[model samples]
Target: MSGTRRLFAELAILGGLILVLAALGPFGSYATPLGPRLLHWALYLVTGYAFFRPVIAAGSALARQMGMSRLVAIAVACVLGAFPTNVIFVFAAAGPAWRSVTASDLAGAYLQTLIVGATVTIVQLLAERGAVPASPAPPTPALPDPQPAAAADATEQEVAPALLDQLPPHLRGPILCLENEDHYVRVHTLHGSALVLIRMRDAVAQLEGQGERVHRSWWVARRAVAGAVRQDRNWKLRLIDGREVPVARASVADLRVLGWLGDAPPAA
Candidate 1:
């Protein structure tokens, strides 16, 4: 489901749970016997669940990115989140009763909550780990020999108009290609650029079929690169009208494959 729909659904569920809990009888009845205490615990659990769910999810995602096993990450995140979760429960419940909560009670509750949250997180992570395959290392490509100066200039001139022709008419001018925080790509056209909301890996795949990634943040039409300049160890691709792009180490192979570094004529 869309994030908005999922958020609304969670909110609806929380509202329902709150209404049900609030309708339950006086605290004095529930406080006396073990059964009443258990009910209060249940209430605390339900109330705390909503607040910690997102925290756990975020932790899991971070762990996954760091190459930790799903199980381990989730467990760590959930466990860490539990203390705060239960504390929230205490603060939330305290207002209605005006009872002074003792330090020891809060500390014990925090520890208990941490244990429970950690246990739940570990179990969930394990379940998730079992469902996914092991990740593979990304493949590396071989680099090409540098192009000779005279020939490279000629190649640049030849590439520009050809690349421009291939682009949709509307995107032919003032295009700004930027990396979206390493996650996705933003294609800026003459008017404006919108976040494409696509994974960088997927964007690379698609662009590889159409052009070449000349820089970490830039993809160029096989025909769009007007020329290139080497300054120290870095190289920059020159586009029509003196536009320049920095070549990323990761993109060098693809740039070579598209013959972007090959010798070409200068634009007249």
Candidate 2:
């Protein structure tokens, strides 16, 4: 499935699970009435998911930097995320009463929320690890007649293979862009995206002469830069495959130097 569809499906599953947990009254009784209690639990689940998802993503980046496997990084991130998520819940669920609560009471509440947070984390890990396979690539049109031997050899020599050599077999192809998220660099191509354990500076270096730095956290292949778009005073690049990459103010000169910022689109 597409990224947007997959996200919606995940949200639906999470919402259903939360609703079931609320109906079961797993905690037995709350100080508030049934209505408020249910709402409180729902809020706890939604807020926890919202806050920790990005935290875990950042953790994944750090883990990559540390040379850890993606799964291990995710596990560590989830464990670390539980503490902060529980703290948020304590105040959210307690509201006005939290100020009067003792340290011991707060600790107890945190412990309880931690268990729920851990459970949700494990569910997410499982879902990610067991992701469905990508669909087959679409058919391409037939190529034209082969070029002369010398010309073909020269074309092959011009295609530098340094970055492609580092990528896994499936991810190898013409690169489209690189997005830095925490400690990991997300490499995008016509085929798909893969997260590599490389800092933004390092990734940009590997693409030298092939791509240009467009943002502090982004690099785009010159060949893949289809056009530019303007949003308010800011600018973004439109990639060949339709991904919109943000262009930093400092890098505006670079794009202009390449003639990419000519006739900027109207702000939306």
- lDDT by residue (tens digit), candidate 1, 75-159: 5667667766877777666776636877776786786567545544443333433432111212211112335534543453354
How well does model 1 score by local distance difference test?
0.51
Number of the top candidate by TM-score?
2
- Error at 91, model 2, angstroms: 12
lDDT of 2 by residue, 196-268 (tens): 7678787777667767887766788776666788889788888667678888888888678777777532121
lDDT of 1 at 1: 37
Clashes of each: 11, 0
Models 1 onward score TM values of 0.35, 0.51
Give the clashing residue pairs of candidate 2, or none: none
What RMSD does model 1 have?
13.3
lDDT for 95 in candidate 1 is 74
